[model samples]
Target: MIKLMRIDYRLIHGQVAMAWTSAIGANCLLVANDAVSKDSMRITTLKLARPAGCKLVIKSVEDSITALNSGVTDPYNLFIIVESVEDAYRLAKGYRNIRSINFGGAKPQKDCTRKLSVTTPVSERDMQLLKELVNEGIEIEIRQVPGDEKINVSKLL
Candidate 1:
């Protein structure tokens, strides 16, 4: 079963490797990012950052969806991580198991000037996707760590 689905540009770091993993009691860290899966150095870094005793599986977005839908991930407590709103939208749209999304870390877009309701920056397309997810009844929130208060995406919408 899925424990959580998170969107953080920095896929695995101290906050995720320690705090979120423990908070959700996740045993498997599934990183669904095509670019990271193809990059050997990134894979190595993410593996090193993963919490001890947890399994890390880095696969392309489509592959991750296949594994999830095929019930291959049913045996383990899965913590899914994606780097973009589009990727998260694809996963949650492809699989009904993903009921919530956490907007953890978003690096600002240098050219984006359209102000969004959220404190941080996001492209207009991404903001639209996020709003659509909320309309679909998927809970979305913003927070850096588990200890921080969850700011619902709907309220900001």
Candidate 2:
């Protein structure tokens, strides 16, 4: 079962490892990112950062979808984290079970044309994809942590 799907640039950090995992009662942290899956050092660092008692599984978006679809991760309460809106869109599109996404942190890009929040800077392309996701019935909530009040992305747009 997927407890939450969050898009945070800093994938498995203190906030996620401590707050979000406990808030969601998630036993598994699934990071769906192509780059992180291939980097040995990055994977090791994330594993080290994860809170004890929580299993960390890093896989590409496609592979993650395959695992979810094949019942490979059905036993655990899964918390899915992706780095970008593009990756979130890909995962949500591939898996119908992901009905909502929490936008945690997105660093400013050089091409950023708009600021969604203090931590989230969006390019025109990012805005479009986000709007499309909303239109497709995926709820978008902008919040730094589980205790914070959720700001609807629709109102921000």
The stretch of ten residues in a row with the least summed lDDT in candidate 1 is: 111-120
Q: TM-score of predicted model 2?
A: 0.98
What's the CA error at residue 152 for candidate 2, in Å?
0.5
What tens digits encode model 1's per-residue C-alpha lDDT throughout 1-157? Answer: 8998999888998888999999999999999988998999999999889899999999999999999999999999999999988889999988887889998876668755543435457888888998999999999998878888888888876
TM-score of each: 0.94, 0.98
Off by over 4 Å in 1: 114-119
Candidate 2 lDDT over 69-123, as tens digits, reads: 9999999999999999889999988888888999999967999999888988988
Error of 1 at 84 (Å): 1.1
Judge candidate 1 at residue 103 and give its lDDT: 88
